[model samples]
Target chain A: MHIAFDPRLRVAGPLQALDARCKVLAFFALVACAASVPAPSWRAPVAFLGAATLLLLVSRIPLGAALRRLLFLVPVVLALAAVVPFAKAAGGEKVALWTGGPMVPRQGLLVLWNVSSKALVGLLCAIILAGTTGVPRLLEAFERLCVPRVLVLTMSFIHRYAITMQEELARMKRARDARGWRGRWIWQAGTLGSMAGTLFLRSYERGERVWQAMLARGYRGKLIGPSSAPLRLLDVMFVVWMLAAGLAIRFLVR
Target chain B: MTAPAIRVSALTFRYPDGTRALDDVSLEVAPGERVALLGANGAGKSTLLLSLNGLCDPGGRVEIGGTPVGSRNLPEIRRRVGLVFQNPDDQLFCPTLFDDVAFGPRNLGLGEEEVQKRVHEALHRVDLATLEEKPSFHLSYGQKKRAALATVLSMQPEVLALDEPTSALHPRARREMIALLRTLSCALVVATHDLEMARELCPRAVVMARGRIVATGETSVVLADTKAMDEAELL
Candidate 1:
């Protein structure tokens, strides 16, 4: 199965028009604000979700694609949220589990709602940002934002090669299937583990070869790039508007 | 005009698990010589190429321009020898084609203007000038290979070491690569089983098998030696 982020989402057009640093900071700030509000307050989450939806609509990305990406996180959040009510007692006071008592807490449902909504909103913001910006532009933006060069370099390589690794995995799976080695769930797990091991080794070898190639070109442990386009006044204005709207929602709306 | 550009003497190597990869190999190439290393699979051709740039340890018996391969001379040696790996995906690790081509020059601490100049020149050399801003992954295989070549060429190395440079290239792309390599003045060492390519592009040929050099001479004679070619599995 392909695990790579879609490339079509990264093509330059409407999304490329906006500065990457602005989008990253804005998304991050929104996520932090979304996470900080108490779970019991539904109004904050509703406001955050509404803001994210508005941004998505204005960005001109297809609504279906955005929702599809957001949907990927639903199962995980739901699984984590499922156990909340059963784990805690409903009343403020806890009672023995084996004894006859209403052990589940009423606040547990509120906590679950809070966690799920925050996670969904946070994920939505991230998806929108990633969908708009290509990986290289995003890395360049991070570098401009003063992110450590090593981290930027690492993420850049990861984004470039993740698809290659996925292709390698697909090839291995095809080879295994050709050998007629179909099996049950546990056997499949074993096969997957071996595939993971092989992928790791191959990636490690590729890493060495890439480094050697780098050295051949006079690489000295530091990454360098061309002079990027300077942030325009419009990019600054975009950031100001996003921050203002976010702050207005958080502090003023209440 | 001076010493041979590359010198290898009694070069031997073994992997960590003790599998001998190269054995008692000795050779030399003068400046501007285009040499093809012809071998079948598992012939240790790549191992030898890697040794030229200090990517592989040769147990202390390899030299470039009369200077022995060592930690002290490695950076200088690497700057002089551009090694293009078989896979473009592995070689072009940077996110964008521009960054990948500029990587080597940037690492050399060149100014941003110089880096851009080299990147443009290298891309122009490989006929990839229009793809400066494209991501590496989005390019077709032929384009990726050309970009990979540009990545190394930007460094302007005196010696170019290529491993399977045309293995998966289309016919047109292969022709383009051979033409490009011919126009370059640097000493070229290409390791491949493509006898046709060797016949067309290189004046000299080396036959390798099981980590040993079986024959080396004028490309036509060495490649025409049926018995030696058979023994080395090149034929």
Candidate 2:
């Protein structure tokens, strides 16, 4: 159940030293601008992708590790891109060129490039942000940035216990397999359904116990958190530089 | 004489489904005294620990640090009685060991400096100072159990109520825990089935069966009584 893209990097780097709030704000702004790049334009997307790669390097994240993170998102993007080249043909538009035997419409190819490029840029921005920050600090940054408390707490719990829950599911699967249940037929899905029900019950009961434990340790209505230190000069400069770069690409690159 | 660390009289509790988890239970622990609560499963040892800090709805009298256990003084009672759950996973819910250990002290409204001091001291006491930044899931079972104790220790409670602290631990870990517990000055009420641990740590022991106290005496004497041990199913 070990996931490959562990967000918490143990190495020290410039990005790791920056305040988490600054990093969060800068990376998200960049992601938003990358998402809004015009479909027909390649300059903005390429610029953003290069900037993201530079940030990744500055963050001390290995190129191989960063690329491995794309394994989850690249397949879906490629699948859609693969399908887009035929949309114009299905719509009865004229093909300007033929690649080998198949008719490749210019509009379809443009749409394919538009989708793949923007998606890759956005995904790279996210990878840089996550790979540099610890989940606890990230949650604290979200809380300070005025995200809804419910959402922050939900994400915090997921970060803390998701692995444990995954382990529980894995153990249940092993027990099911040990019972000589091959689960080859569709009708055997009844066992899977029951297993899901059992997992839900176990999780619900564990939640109760956690609440009681919280109460035992003097938890009141509010969760008191430590006050974060003020942002440093370096942090401010990093964020301002990211904003400037994003704006320059957004307005000037076109 | 100093007031008892914990006092209970005629305490009764029933689950929502009308199962009587505890019935007419009464006990007391002297200051700085270690007492073992010996019982089989379903004998209400955990229910009694829950009632110590007002975590459950129990009728009758329960007091910690001479304050009555009720909704009005629940915060104070919880700060006075540190209750450790049997499962460390349930207790160590925070993202990192430092966060988990800091949780109780932060909840107690201490300043950031004081909170940090207590967190560091607690982790140091449990020999986990180096792993404070690591996530709880990364810790082994033994480390998680000790981290669970540190979570409560940071609160500086007057009495420590531990549920099965030695259960499922290796011999070396059990020995380490026993040596660690020997260093605590506060009163302790440990609920466990490990009779050898009970003999080594507790001077007095209380045996419970069917939500009732079946036997209470010196640890060695009660454990040696074959008749009482058979009736309580401890043997």
Candidate 3:
């Protein structure tokens, strides 16, 4: 429900200096190619991972931070692929882990490997992209890319007010805690439910005020111009190099 | 002489739930005049501000710069009448301080360079220039308030409508906010309880009660009217 609201992370950096559109396109292409890399070989996947690491180093993003975020997904990926090595697959070879235990399927293990590697590469590329670009910059990039205006504006507002919403919730919780009322199972459910209801109404009222504010600033159904600068030569070069690397991995590396 | 920068005549508004928020409110603000809208909570101060910007559902006479507030004229009227809402979060819906400040000018269809210039000027006026690229959520309450004001100031509106600009700030920040409002040359209608602020920044005052304009005169004179203040329950 909460992401870091840290503004210090978005200050000028090597990757932040690149245009948002370039980073978006480059990272997106890298993810797509990484996802499409043919299985049965470690070459493409290794290259994709190397490129992601290169981006992290160049962006000066903390590897620790990226790895920490990646850790959140470990359990999810593990859950999805947990049964793979245990389940038998068609035309699969079996290997014995111990003398009496059920055999592990070789094809299932390979499949799990392929799935986990691709996911890692895709996740790393995304982490790097997000770590480098600010939400405002990302929205502008989306607008310049001809994404739907309503979607871009929705994301912008959500990002803008999320902290406010968090603060409101925190205030409500504090008020609740100060009453010194003992909470049991019955009280807990009712209190939490009512709290949610109150939050919904408060958010709705804030939405009305925000809408009025938007109208007061001459918003005529559509948001105003993004007013971003043209993509620079560095941006073009970055995209070109990334797309080329992606295409090479997808087509030539085989 | 010239027409009032903002003219409201018999402006009545009611919520869908059958609560009347405004009742035939009539007021006018001459060019460059500063007016305070004083009322207790639920006195319809904010409702009247909404009506002035034509954000209320149709049934009111509102004019900005001699232009009527209507469906077609809404954009022009809105651009001319910059309304800073009570909550900075409401007024600032942009991710970055720069975007929030430039929103008005961008809506006005100004060029990129012009938008940048106006944004810089507005932020400088609010002393938020160093934090222009920072996300608004990253700002403190006072910074957010000033940034919200900058959002309206960037429009270069002929008239400004502020709802409790000094509500959530510290004493020092409140003083700074008043000084910032005092520097602007446009006609202003600030709905607030800051009497000292009204006295210092706004020369004229109008008090509302039961959704109607109960008193209107010089700030000193209106503030001195004990009977009117008592009836309005502003004490």
How close is every model to the real structure, measured as TM-score?
Answer: 0.83, 0.89, 0.90
User: Candidate 1: where are CA atoms >4 Å away?
Assistant: A1-5, A11-15, A85-89, A92-107, A140-157, A174-197, B1-3, B65-69, B111-117, B130-140, B169-173
Residue B3 of candidate 1: its Cα lDDT?
Answer: 82
Better of 1 and 3 by TM-score: 3
Model 3 reaches an interface RMSD of: 2.0
Return whichever of 2 and 3 wins on TM-score. Answer: 3
Ranking by DockQ: 3, 2, 1
Reference-based TM-score, model 1: 0.83
CAPRI-style grade of the A/B interface in model 1: medium
**What is the per-residue lDDT of model 2 for residues B1-235, given as tens digits with 9 covering 90 to 100?**
7778889999988888987888899998998999999999988999999999899879889988778899999889988999999999999877578988998999999999999999999999999999998878789999999999999999998999999999999999999999999899999999999999999999999998888888899999999988878877889
Q: Per-residue error at B199 for model 2, in Å?
A: 2.0
TM-scores of the candidates, chain A only: 0.81, 0.80, 0.81
Q: Which of the two, 2 or 3, has more DockQ?
A: 3
Taking candidate 3, what TM-score does its chain B reach relative to the real chain B?
A: 0.97
Best-matching candidate per lDDT: 2
Over the stretch A103-201, how does candidate 1's per-residue lDDT look in tens digits?
Answer: 556567667777888888887777778778756567768888899989987886676567667667777889999998787677577888888899988
Report the Cα lDDT for residue B159, model 3.
93
Model number with the top TM-score: 3
- Judged by DockQ, which candidate is best? 3
lDDT tens digits, residue span A106-134, model 3: 76766677678788888787777777876
Q: Write the per-residue lDDT of candidate 2 for residues A148-176, one digit (tens) a residue.
A: 98998887667545655666788799999
Native-vs-model 1 lDDT?
0.80
